[model samples]
Every structure is written in C-alpha cells, then in structure tokens.
Target: MLAAIVGRPNVGKSTLFNRLTGTRQAIVDDESGVTRDRVYGEAEWEGRTIPLVDTGGYVPRSDDPFERAIREQAETALADADVILFVVDVTTGLTDVDQEIAQVLRTADAPVMVLANKADNQEREWAASEFYQLGLGEVYPVSGTTKRGVDEMMSALVEALPEETDEETPDRTRISLVGKPNAGKSSLVNATLGFDRAIVTETPGTTRDAVHSVVRYEDQELLLIDTAGMRKTSKTEGVEYYASVRSEQTIRDGDVCILVLDATEEIHKQDLSVLTTVNEHKKGMVIAVNKWDLVPKDGGTMDQFTKYLRQYLGTLDHVPLVYTSAVTKQRVYDLLDTALEVAEKRAQRVQTSDLNDVVQAALRKKHPPSMSSGAFVKIKYATQVRTAPPVFVFFANHPEGVRDSYKRYLEGEIREAFGYDGVPLTLVFKEK
Candidate 1:
C-alpha cells in the first residue's frame, strides 16, 4: 500500500515521515520548502511494511516556478496513493493555508486522515480538536519529534489499508544514472527508454528526486534510477543539499551506476567525487561521455579524450566508457549494454582452485616486501569470501607483514587471470 504525506510548508510532514519510516531518509529542517520532491520510504507497522511518499509543501496559488513544480509532484502522489496523511500544526491553530489544503483532500478518492502534529502538551492536544472543523476525518493528535500518538495513527492506518496480496516482485538490475548538474543524465534516460521518463530542462538541478523507471531490454529487466546532479556540499544549500543526500542513498541501493559526463566540458572535481563515491561503495560503474554529437571530433579525438580521462581516473581506469548522444540516440543502447555487463561482472564468482593458482603465481613472481621488524610473510592459501563486489580472503603466516604494494600486485594478478572489470575487489588478509 502507498501512503502520501501532504500539507503546507513546515507542517512537520518530513518529521512524521522519518518517524514512521524509522529512517532519517527525509531531511528535516526549520526552513520551509526544504523538501521539493517526493521522497520514498517504507514504514513497518504490525509486521506490515507500507510504502510512504513524503512530498514537498503544497502551495495552491503560488506564482513561483519551483512552488508550481512542487504542487504538481504532490498532485501526482495524491493521485496514486491509497491513503493521504494531511499534516497540520497544532501549536499554531488552523490557518488559511491549512484550510485550502483541507479543501483539496476532502475531494481526494483515498481516505484522508488529519495528523495534528506538535501536540506535545495537553494544551496543544486540545488545540488539535479545532482541526475537526475541516471535516476531513478523524484528527489524531501526534508529535512527530517525540513520536507520541504515532502508534495509534499507524494502527488505524494499517487497518484502513486494503487486504494484502501475494504478488511476486520481478528481479531487476538497478542502474543509477548519476553526474554533475546538466551533464545529460536525464536526457540519457529519456533516450534509452525512447520516452521522457524524467523531466529534462536546460536548467541545472531540474531533477531534484531520484526517479525510477522499469524497462525490459532483451531478456533482462532493468530499473533505471535518474538522480539529481551532485554538487559540492560547501556550495549547496536547502533543497539541493538534501537532493545530494538522496543521490548518495541511491548509489548505495543501486547495482550499477552510470557516471554521465558532458563531452563538451572538461571533467570537473565534482565528477571525480561522484566516481569516488561509487567506488567507495564497491558498486559496479560505467563512465558515459554524453553529448558526443556536439563535440568536434577528429581521427584521434576519442583516443586523446580517453587518455585524458584515464589520467584523472588513475586506479579506476578499468571502468568501461561509452560515448553517447541522447539527441541523436548515438550509442545510447550501447551504454545500457555496458552497464549490464558490469552488473554481471560484479556478480561473478571465482573457483577456489582458480583463485589460489593466480595468488601462487603472483607470490612466486614477486615476494611480499619484508617488514621493518624483518618478520617473514608467507601466504598459505586464498579463497573468495563473497561476490557482487568480489571479496577474497588470503591466509598468511604474518598477515600484518603484507605490504600495500604487494597487495596491489596480487590484485593485478587476480584481475589478469579472472576479469572483474568495472567492479571493485576487496582483499582481506588474515593470520593463519
């Protein structure tokens, strides 16, 4: 079941969302309009998990472009939700904005339940009774900060939801398209899906949410997540700051990430930051040089650009790169194919015998450097401990004596023998 939390700005909708979902996924702030997009999370109550959407502040008669966009997002959530959580502030009595929002919820098809938030004291809880004049439904006095009265609200909410059904969720390879602002991440998504799956604008940070779309390519089902452009935290504020946080969460949830770069502009530090984030999470990645149609190219342009990127992507040179043009649909499908290949490589498992053979050969080629204490280091055997970001554990007589340089040598030999392209490898050394 899907439930949407909607109300005017700073009515504690995000606070309530975080409280129920048991996660700090939605950013809470004193500033109004902090949440400009629909943030999705799951709420577990009475052994049942209900999907929740926290929307931006709903402004009825706003002329601001952002406010209008926020209203549209809220309306979309309202249209699809099974239940509506209309939040109101009890500390401050009924207001004109609250009245306007209540009017709209009365006409909604879903059951509307008013949440009188900030009712920490008996006085404030008494003030919550005034909201009944809106005539939406039962007014539950709750405090999102203290989580008081939330259980009663959720218990009622779960009973109000439709009966559960046993439906199977399809297995999908989640591919996250992430990059700096206006790097053509959304355009790539629209092109790959052959439709406007995401709102594309010339303006930077147009997509403030991690929008998800499912598509079937060949025999594989893929979940494409188009995320907001990541900017340096020092320069970001308010909504954009939270947008960056959402993008980081998307990276952790994704199976493979496609780092989109504008071919016309030189790679920036922000782009490298995104790359490092994906690497640090140990997620499979593919580098996409977008807007190839706009770039002036010669016989060696691609080769020179590849070399330039390699310099910046020192250790990440193994990641696959595909030059694409969303406008002309040039190599757009190829990018998807490369991402799928990276996903497969991430899930690849190696046999114990094959793994040990490579480790033995690497040790014979170059012995591990000795420690300052001159303790002898002898590696006994190696085994893969995990897949989907393959991790190998090596047993050694003195694991602490293995040098970083020798570790790199062993990693190189393993990669040479068994390809793990576009996937991070974790090597653990243990004393036998």
Candidate 2:
C-alpha cells in the first residue's frame, strides 16, 4: 500500500513524512519549497511495511516553472497513491491555498484524510477542529515533530488501507540503474522494455523519483528500478540534494546496480564516486558504457576503453563492463543478462571443505608478512559465513596482524577456486 502526503508550502509535510517513515529521508527545513520532488520511504506500522511518498508543496496555479513542476509531481503522487494525507496548519487556520488544495483532493479517486499538523498542545489541538470547514472528512490533530496523536492517526490510516496479499515473488532479481544525469539510464530502460516507461528528455534531472517496473526474461521476473541522476553534493541545491540521497538509498535496497556512463565523455571523478558507493555497500555491480553507437570506435577501441575504465575502478576490477546503445537497443538485453549473472554470482556459496582447501593452498603459496614483534601470524581455518555478497571469515591466533595485502591475496585465491565475478567479497579475520 502507498500513502502520499500533500499540502501547500511549509505545511510540515516533510516533517510528517519523516515522522511516519521513522527516517530522516525527507529534508525538513523551515524554508518553503525545500522538497521539490517526490521522495519515497517505507513506514512500518502495525506489523506492515507501507510505502510512503513525500511530495513538494502543492501550488494550485503557478507561473513559476519550479512550482508548476512541483504541482505535476504532487498530482502524479495522488494518482498512484492508495490514500492521500492532506495536511493543514492548525496555527494558521484555513487559507486560500488550503481551500484550493482541498478542491483538487476532492476529485481524486483515493480517499483523502485531513491532517491538522502542529497541534503540539491542547489549545492548538482544539484549534485543529477548524480544518473540518475545508469539507474533508476525519481531521486528526497531530504534531509531526512532537509525536502527538501520531499513533491515533496511524491506526486510522492502517485501518483504512486495503488488505495486502502475498504477491511478492521471492525469486525476483531487483536491478537498479544508477548514474549521473544524462547518462542514458532512462533511455536504456526505455529501450530495454521497448516502451516509454520513464519520461525521457534532454533535461539533465528529468527523473527525480526512483521508478520501478517489472518484466519477465526467459520466464524469470526482474524488477528494474530507475533512479534520479546523482550529482556532487557541493553542486546540488535543495531538491537535487534530496534526489541524490534517495538514489543512494535505492542502491542499498537493490540486488544489483548497473552504473551507466556516457560513452562520449571520459570517466569523471563523479563516476568513480558512484562506483565506490556500490563497492562500499558490497552490492553486485555492472558498468554500462551507454551511447556506444555514438562513440568512434576501431577493432581495439572497446578493449582500450575497458582497460582505461579498469584503471579507474581499481580494486573493483571484477565488476563486468558492457558497451550499450540505448538509442539503437544495441546489447541492452545483453546488459540485463550480465546483471542477472552478477546477481547469481553474488548469491553463490562455497562448501566449507572447498573454502578451507583454497585457504590452505593460498597459505602455502605465500606466508603472511611477519608481525612487528617478528612472530608469524597463523591463520588456522576459514569458513564461508554468508552469501548474497559472499562473506568469508578467517580465524587466527593474531587476527589483527593480518595485513590488507595478504587479505587481497587470499581473496584472489578464492576467486580462482570459485568464481565470484562481479560480486563484492567480504573477508573477516577474527581471533580464534
């Protein structure tokens, strides 16, 4: 179930969103129009995880381009929501903008609940009764900051939502397409799906929200999440900053991420920054050099480009690279296939005997560097502890003495014994 928060400027919609979602995902500030796009989060209430969206302030009619864009985003949220929370300020009473928003909400297909925000005390809570004049049913006086009457409002919200089913498939692979703006992430999605599921334009920040779509390939379901373009925090303003935050959050939630790059442009520092984020999160990743058809290439051009990219990737060299052309649909499906393969590798597990065999072989090939005291650090045994971003734990008498260089050598040996291509490996050294 999806619930959306909507109101005019500075009605504390973002604060309410943060309150409901139990996260500071939405940027809350005293300034009006801080949130200019749709930000998504999941709220856990009454043992259910409900999807919630916080939208920009609703402007009934506006000549300003930003305001118009915000209005469209709010309307889109309303269309997709299962229920709408129309927030109003009890301190200010009803105003012209509130009335205008009410008029718009009245036409929505979903049920609308009026939230009288900022009722921190009993006196202000009494004033919340005035919002009933707006003609929306069930006005609940609550404070997004103080947590007053929030539970009562949530109880009603959960009761009002439709019952959910066990429709979520367990075998589905979620692939998130993330990169900087105008990198053809959306274009690649449209080309792969053969439909315009996402809005495509020359505008750099055209996609502000992470859009999700499901498709079947070879009878296997795949969930494709298209996220907003990530920009440097120093260059982002209020809206773009929050969009970047949402994109990063999407990376953590995805099974595998496809980092799209513009083929015509040389790899930028910002691109490496994104690659590092995926690597640090221990998420499976694939680098897609998009607009491949536009690049002037010879027989060895792709090879040279791959070598250059690997230099930037550094230790993340295991991440697979694919040359794609979204405009021509060149190798788009091949990119998806590669992502699926990476996801499989991410979940691959090694038997304990095989793990120890590889570890023993690695130790025989190269003894670990001696400790500062000139004592040898002995790694007694190793075990495969987890999968899906496979993890291996090594026990030793002096675990802290194991150098990072030695860890890399052990990881290399494990990869040779068992292929974990395009997947991050976590090695944990613990005292026996």
Candidate 3:
C-alpha cells in the first residue's frame, strides 16, 4: 500500500519520511521547497511493508513556478496513494496553510490522518490541540526528529492500511534496468514492451521516475522497471536527486538488475557507482551493453569489451553480460531469459552436508593465512546459513586471522562445487 506525505513546506515531512523508511532517500534540509519531487520508500511496521511517498510541499493557489510544479507532483503522488499522512508543525501552531491542506484532502478518496510534528515534549504535544480545527480526524502528536510517538503513528498507519497477502508467484522476476542517463534504458524497456511504454528521447533525464510494466512473455512473468538516467550527485538537482534515490530503491526492490551500459561510451565512474549500488544490494545482476548496433564490431570486439568490464568489475566478473540493441531488437528478448536465469541462481540452495564437504576439500587444498602474531585461522565447520546471495558462515578458532584472500579462495571453491554462477556469495567468519 502507498501512503503520501502531504503538508505545507518545512513541516518536517522529509524527516518523518527518513524515520519511517530508515533511509535518507528524501533530501531533508532547513530550506523550504528543497524536495521538489515525490520520493517513494518502503516503511516496514509490524511485519507489513508499506510504501511511503514523500511528496513536495503543498502550496494552494501558488504563483511561483517551483511551488506550482511541487503541487503538481504532489497531486500525482496522491493519485497513487491509498492513504494521506497530513503533516503539520506543532511548534508553529495551526496556520492557514494547514487549513488549505485539510480542505484539499477532505474530498480525497483516501483517508487523511493529521500528524502534529515537533511534539517532542508534553508541552508541544499539548500545543498540538489547535490542529483539531482542521477537523479531518483525530490528531496524532509525534516528533519527526526524535522519533517520539513514531511507533504509535506507524501502528495507526498499519491499521489504516489494507491487509495484504502473498499473491506473487515465487518465479516472477523483477528486472530493474539501470545505468547513466542516455544509456538507452528507457528505449530498451520500450522495445522490450513492444510499445512506447516509456518516453524515449535523445534528451538526458527524459524519464523523471521509475516506470513499472508487467509483461508475461513465453511463461516468463517479469516486472520491467525503467528509471531516469542518474547523474553524479554534484550534477543532480532536486528532481534528479529524487530520481537517483528512487533508482537505488528500485535496485533494492528488484530481483535481478539488468544494468544497461552505453556501448559507444567508455565505462565511466558513474557507471561504476551504479555497479557498487547493485553489488551492495546483493541483487542478481545481468549487464547489457546497449546500442551495440552503433558500436563497430570485429570478431574480438565483444571479447575486448567483456575483458574491460571484467577488469573494472573485479570480483563480480561472473555476472552475465549480453550485447543488446533496443532499436535493432538484437538480443533484447534474451534479457528476460538472462534475468530469469540469474533469479534462478539466487534461489538455488545447497545442503549442509555437500557444503561442508566442499569446505573440507578447499581447506585441505589451501590452509588459511597465518597471521604474524602466530595465530592461525582454523576452521571447525561450515554451513549454508542463508540463500539469496547465499551466505556461508565459517566458525573458526580465530576468526580475526581469516584473511580476505582465503575467504575469496573458499568462495571460489564453493562456487566451483555448487555452481552458483551469476550470484554473489557472502562469506562470514565467526569464532567458534
């Protein structure tokens, strides 16, 4: 379920958003109108994942261009939300803007809950009584800064949200197409969808938000997410910054991220930054060098391109790579197949017995690195502790002496034995 955070500017809505989502996705600042776009985040409260949208400040009858844009964006977010979390500043007391917001949400299909923010103390909480004049419903006093009363607020929100059930198939693959702007991510998605689902143009940053499309092609059910081209932090402004954060959120939400790299351009720092996000998220990945039709190719061109990518990707070299052209429709359909392939690998599991056997063989082949202090890492046993970027915990005599090199070697051996290709492995060293 989606909930839109609506209020006048500078009322700590973004602060509340950060508290709820446990992420700094929305740019919080003292300056009013800093958040020019609606930023969506996941808020997990009482085992339920609620999608929260931090909307731009609502200014009624605003003549300013930015304020008008903010209001438009907030309305767009409101249409998608099931609930509206109307925020107000208790310290500043009730104001005309508060009344304007209340009046606007009165006819909304979703219910509005008044949040009297800055109620960090009993005095402020008491001061929030005037908010009753809005007459939407009962006002809940909470501190967005201290997070005081946030649990109660979230609990109230949970009650307001509709109950959810597990309806998604386990095999449904969510593919997030991501990369720098103008890398043809939107074009690729449009081509894959066989229609102009996403707006494609030569202009950078044409896509302002993540466009989601559900398609079933030959038994493969896929959620294709096409997001705006993300520039460097220094280059990003209000809307673009929100887009970048949403891109990261999209990465986390996806099962397998198909990174679309520009074949004509050299691999850039921003491209690597995206790779870092994909790596950090531990999502299964497939790299697609888009616009391959534009690249002059020889027999060894693909090999050289892959070699360069491997040099940069280093440990993540095993991720599947495909040369694709959205315009030519060359290898575009294969993206879904590769994404499903990666998703399958992410769900693959190994038995404790087989994993321990592989561990024993690896340890016998190469002993753990010896520390200069004479302490050596001695493995007692190994187990497959988790899946989804399969984590293996190795209990040892001295976990501190387990060097990174040995961990990589053990991971390689485990991969060789189990064939967990196209999936990142997590190695954990713990003292027995």
Question: What clash pairs does model 2 have?
Answer: none
Compared with the true structure, what per-residue lDDT tens digits does model 3 show for residues 271-290?
Answer: 87787778888898889999
lDDT per residue, candidate 1, 1-432, as tens digits?
Answer: 678788788989999999998899788898887775546778999989897878757433446664444445445556657899989999778987777667666678889899999998888889999999999879999999998899999999998888898898778999999999899999999998899989999999999889999999989899999999998765554467557757876888899999999999988988988899899889998999999999988899999999999888988888889999999999999999999988988998899998888888888888887777887799999999899889999999899988887887787788768877788889999989
For candidate 3, the TM-score is 0.82
TM-score of candidate 1 to 2 decimals: 0.66
For residue 191, model 1's alpha carbon misses the true position, in angstroms, by 0.8
C-alpha RMSD values across all candidates: 6.2, 5.4, 4.0
Q: Give model 2's TM-score versus the native structure.
A: 0.72
Error of 3 at 355 (Å): 2.1
* Candidate 2 CA-lDDT value: 0.86
- How would you encode candidate 2's per-residue C-alpha lDDT over 1-432 as one tens digit per residue? 678788888989999999998888788888887775546778888998887877656433447564454445445656657899998999899997788778777888888999999999999999999989888799999999999999999999998888887797667899999999999999999997889999999999899889998988878999999999999755564456556756877888899999999999878889988888888788999999999999887899999998988887888887889999999999999999999999998998888888998899889989988889988899999998899889999999899899999999899888767877678899999999
CA lDDT, candidate 3, residue 109: 83
Give the TM-score of each candidate. 0.66, 0.72, 0.82
